[model samples]
Target: MSPLVLGPLVRCVEATSAAVWVETAAAARVEVRAGDATGEAATFAVHGHHYALVVVDGLPIGAATAYEVLVDGVPVWPEPGSPFPPPVLTTIDETEPLRLAFGSCRTSVPHDAAGNGSHGVDALRAYAMRMADLVPAEADPDGGAPRWPDLLLFLGDQVYADETTAEMRSFITARRDIDEPPWDELRDYEEYAELYRLAWSDPAIRWLLSTLPTAMIFDDHDIRDDWNTSLTWRRAMEATSWWHDRIVAGLASYWVHQHLGNLTATERALDPLWRRVLDHEGPEELDLSEAIDAFADRADQDPTSYRWSFVRDFGNQARLVVVDSRAARVLEPGRRSIIDDEEMAWLDEQVRGGFDHLLLGTSLPFLLASGLHHLEAFNEALAAGAWGDRAARFGERLRQGVDLEHWAAFQAGFAEVSRMVVETASGRRGPAPATVTFLSGDVHHSYVSEAQHSRARRRAGAPPLQSRIVQAVCSPIRNPLPRPVRFATAFLSYGVAGVLGRGVALLARAPRPILRWSYVRGPWYDNNLATLEVHDRDLRMWWARGVVDGDDHARPRLEQVADFSLDAPERSQRRRKRRAANRSGEAPSAFARRRSISST
Candidate 1:
């Protein structure tokens, strides 16, 4: 295949410049046009399934406007049947704060398939089909529908190479039998490329990505389950020759489909792969499709070689540290770190500078539910050889990349980040910590946890790195977890957690560690959407899911599952006391990102 010119991906937009990622299935001369015959055109070529990053410079600093994509002078998307024309380039208005809707683990479930009749609205598709609508012209200021997002951040699971949809399965099953070891999933670059199409090609989703400026990161499902954990896991897989091609295709295609979309201007200017794409000027000479396959193979087999994570700071008020926890892992013994030193150092620096709020976008959350946390902890200890016999073998299997989960398994790295979150929020390193909120997913559930910082862990009157920290999770957009598993997880989290599992493993010379579940303060479920608002010095979070409303396809609102507030108790308490004393309702507008009076 050639470069998939499937997109004019509206990528990063800062104050004055916005980045648009253009790709073709094959090499093609590409030019982007904005505005009337002001005739300013920036031209580049698309590499095979590889993107050519074109910075649409000198755009307006703020406000809305629509733009166009010209591939060899042809308007591909919004060519016809597009729900909305792409948004005009606007600087990321951080002072105004951001109201972004985010969630992950979407499957290619039909938007209005009668089988899923209970929930009529496919939240992802609905957002697209509704974003750019045709309103009556008499509305003057062109009063049709509202432009949906200033930005859309997709955290992870945008595609599943491991799991296939019924439609996708038909192709896979017909082309090749999946009864083999790596059956029921994707295994190579070609397959991975198709996965991306099945995922984002939906008319509604493509509509959103075309218009709403987006930032993305990948989790395990983007490739496979428990992608990279330890050296043993890598060795276990290396036993098969097919593993080489599978991983190569996965990482190579992942670079094309997702990671490239996250690169900044300077990064692309210096990018080894894309620099050539931009410089060469023609598609045939830039035949990187085969070479990138090999490069991805090397990166996956040798995790220490290349880095996949990145960081972005939205002015000084907010900073984003995107952890590439899966790709750059140091899985070797005594050298275990979810992210190698270089990536961690970069993340540390970004978080060091103070911000009103810090958003850590790791595909996996640092904090796990009490139940899940304990289970992982027990597994960690077992894997680390606290127990004897097969306990160690079992633990090894779990950690040696059994499941690509949170940091806990990589204890040293987990401890380092946990301390970072605590210290950053406590005001020890920077300001007396503002709000350190970790935004994450991939655990197949949605949740919010508040981290209470304490100075007790330290001596003296040291400002406790103890402050309120919040962790929120949203996963598997269309794939709901089983009810039985939810209950089992609850029992394991609360009941089997702590050290009893460690004791059993030990007394039988196979002691399992204790992983208590008391820390979990919320409910868990499969398939939901989580949206949050961090304003007014208070943090509020809510989770919702799709639901059929009054037998209407034309209208649907988010149905709320839970709402919780993580306010600076010190501030909220003060506000309460002052309000009572003064009889006032002074909620700050900065924090007034509100929900409807009756949350649907």
Candidate 2:
């Protein structure tokens, strides 16, 4: 058997089971051993490539268990005499608060000085180093300090099929004729497999993957820039011969590699594709090439067929609903939406309250800068024929050219999700969550925004506000926007765009946004990773980036950019209730001091 090519990656973990994904140069039976619990699964073939998802079961809930990987009964991971720490599988605990790390947009390149200088430092790698340093040099009975997060959420753009680094370009050139229409971008399954290997093979990132239980969703760049952005773009792509194969390969590989590992055991058992593979009685690695490709084709052609979006209940403590903002879109001209009605119904079902916090992970921000939000809405209106025929044509060109394909661009879809959010926040769906926060990426910058509810929602006889709605965005774990492009984005998102967007909205007769918002944290354009912690009636978030000291680009240091904390809505309500109950003229400061002492 050939050696492991990509991972012993711990993908999705629950209270009792974990999915460890791996890829090898050839077909092999892979096993994951944790304590005495062992699970083995044979590698399946896709386009001549081999991969397996080893589901390790019967794990102790809420605790970390170290695991080792074996390829055909021979140890292959934590490779013999390796210096790095052993891989660990940590299951979720119902009783404990959740701490999650999330970000998106990364490019795979060398970690040397040249790579750093060209592409900026890698924030994820820097985070891995920090996690490693948390362990003590000497062994202790209690084992090294445990500061790992409960889970990690990758918002989108985990891999860039449309963009290529120098190394990627070289590989593509060596393998095929670069003069082809697609040029430096990826072509098919083999190229995508190579891209993933490059993206996940770095020692630090690999270690991070092997330990951190992760869930991911793909954005446009995962397949191509502005994928499924508009009807115009889709028509153009379909006109090309190679585009169909590229999309099929992209979605098929995504299912085999990323999506397959995300499902719970029960969910996997229910999957039609997996059910067929698992039921096979033969003692050979299953080949899912045709089935997976057909499924991908059907999924792309009909967004309602297979739901890419899913919801996870973290033991009733928190709820994570990751929405598919790209592929499951309704891009029918004049009725464009980020998600179709079926998807919207599913999302509505998931957005109900009752958990401490409700996290909506969308690749596109639900609430962009008020200015950008209005601009996208205005563009959508024009593209929908608000303007004259010639002007509408111009609007379509502008929307496709500038990549106006976010929630804001889909007025109906945005309003629907916003209404759901308002309903949940007002406790109409269920017991209101402390916060309804949207975690997002794909704009190439990081920021946090708080929603300002519409006047109508705050009118007389409205349900009392019980949950705070906010948007938190983190992007580009490694890739950086070029200086010129960064300036253009900033101006369009925050500056001149706002002033002109309003006028355009009036001209287009665009409806007023249901909820307006403003940035409270940042619009930082750095390669960074973000972490969110839910504890002590507060939700705190921090962003960090990798920085190189003078002349030491290879050994990048992780530096904190900014951190902000939001008061949990339930906490504020409690304070109000206390004030109402205490009729006496007790000073606010006195109550605060008393509450602080009691909390301690």
Candidate 3:
């Protein structure tokens, strides 16, 4: 009921440092501080709606040390309570066993008051509650949720204007009637600001955001499902009377809600809008309300005018390429590209001279189920009517919101990135990482796969390729596929996709699929969480989900779903440990290979 307020994203955590990037509801002299029992330390000024990255250094290294941040010297947090939780300061630890929980495709909804049940817990929300319970009875107390994550990588769907929550509806209803053609959907920047408030402002969740060092990139749902997939999709939408307004609203809102938080201080300052923002003495930094809306309109009309994707490198070992896989799409005329030549060139150069591991954070998967992946590729070619003119109609139908053309459809870019990974590993391009892994979501299932160029590698005498490729997909933090749908997907992925892909590839005169891969991982569905680790010459990983007992809605337990190590030596060591335990007849059989989903 009272006016909602937010900003100055409290994100980006690493050992001895953290970055605070924020935008305000209004301007005020903002100051940020980080300290522990040693007393006040680390402070900076934050100009209104304009963004600033205040990095705190010299943090104590430990799992249990507590830190606090001050805004305008007011100590903006739960000294006690205002229903709004204040932020907390903690350092990120890269050593020891790592724990990270991430998933996307969430729609905000009203919380069930009685705490008996809610429309299936948001996985993030659930994790936050666990953290809350772990906190000591007072601020800066002795305990909290395992010091939280070093960094939380949010892949996509941060806010959904197209799909909203009940509380969000009331905010809309109070402002304007919902009878407009796109009324149910967001129209511009203002609506987007409010939607983000609803998404991040929940007390438990807000506290988590304040504490967790978060990184994010956008996917289609952040704007709309199947956004910018094809030229026809754009053309048809432009024909609509309300299309421009919708696009304007979507783009403007996105700049504030998602992109602002992700940019480095240097990057934001480089923007023309920020110059105007810095020029203003007023509290509001960049009043993108009108500017972003206009920018979105121009972009939709000329998709190549601006680039929305970026990359961030931490230290010299890892490179995170947050790609603009949705925007800058070349969906017109002869060819379609999710990324233009300039962007691909950037990735090529970045990945070519890499470190220990290369991470590409795209909303869509590069190696999808082979059959469906091929289906999308063939459908795209057929739609272009390279096969026959009549097939174009089917292509139009597919384009009218068909989710086609992932890496398989965009084969050229896929091949380039893959080759880069190989070259990097071979030391021809750069010092090879133990693995080149892709982290993604949107597929609604989680799995890991190993890539190879030939079946010869499958045989003993075959030579090993220079580099190896792996994909890790964790999706829809809360969306569980229906039972029947799951069965259908399994059958299709394993059986149907293979049979069907061969038929289509034969028609296209394509070379027999040179890529050979296997799902030596999982299809586990649980509104799940996972962690990825890259060490000197090995990689280790695991997945987890919340567990509950019969009808008890109070406190769900943490369940370890699956665990595996990529190093053969490590695997052999673990097996030996298990054997030793068995001989002693007192070994802990913690090998839980079973996994499933939990929902309302």
- Candidate 3 per-residue lDDT over residues 231-256, each given as its tens digit: 77777777878777667776766665
Q: What's model 3's TM-score? A: 0.81
Looking at candidate 3, the ten consecutive residues that score lowest on lDDT are 591-600
**Better TM-score candidate (1, 2):** 2
lDDT of 3: 0.61
| Candidate 2 TM-score over all chains jointly | 0.94
Between candidates 1 and 3, the TM-score winner: 1
Candidate 2 lDDT, tens digit per residue, 139-204? 211111236777788888888898887878888999999998788888889899888888888888
Model 1 clash tally, residue pairs? 41
Which has the better lDDT: candidate 2, or candidate 3? 2
Residue 514 error for model 3, in Å? 4.1
Model 3 clashing residue pairs (backbone): 8-22, 8-23, 9-21, 9-22, 27-283, 49-285, 50-285, 77-86, 187-249, 188-249
Q: What is the C-alpha lDDT of each candidate?
A: 0.62, 0.83, 0.61
lDDT computed for candidate 2: 0.83
Off by over 4 Å in 3: 1-4, 14-17, 21-25, 36-73, 82-87, 91-100, 111-119, 133-147, 282-286, 298-305, 399-402, 455-463, 510-514, 548-555, 568-600
Would you list the rank order by TM-score, best first? Answer: 2, 1, 3
Q: Among these predicted structures, which one has the highest TM-score? A: 2
After TM-score superposition, the amount by which residue 559's alpha carbon in candidate 3 deviates from its true location, in angstroms, is 2.4
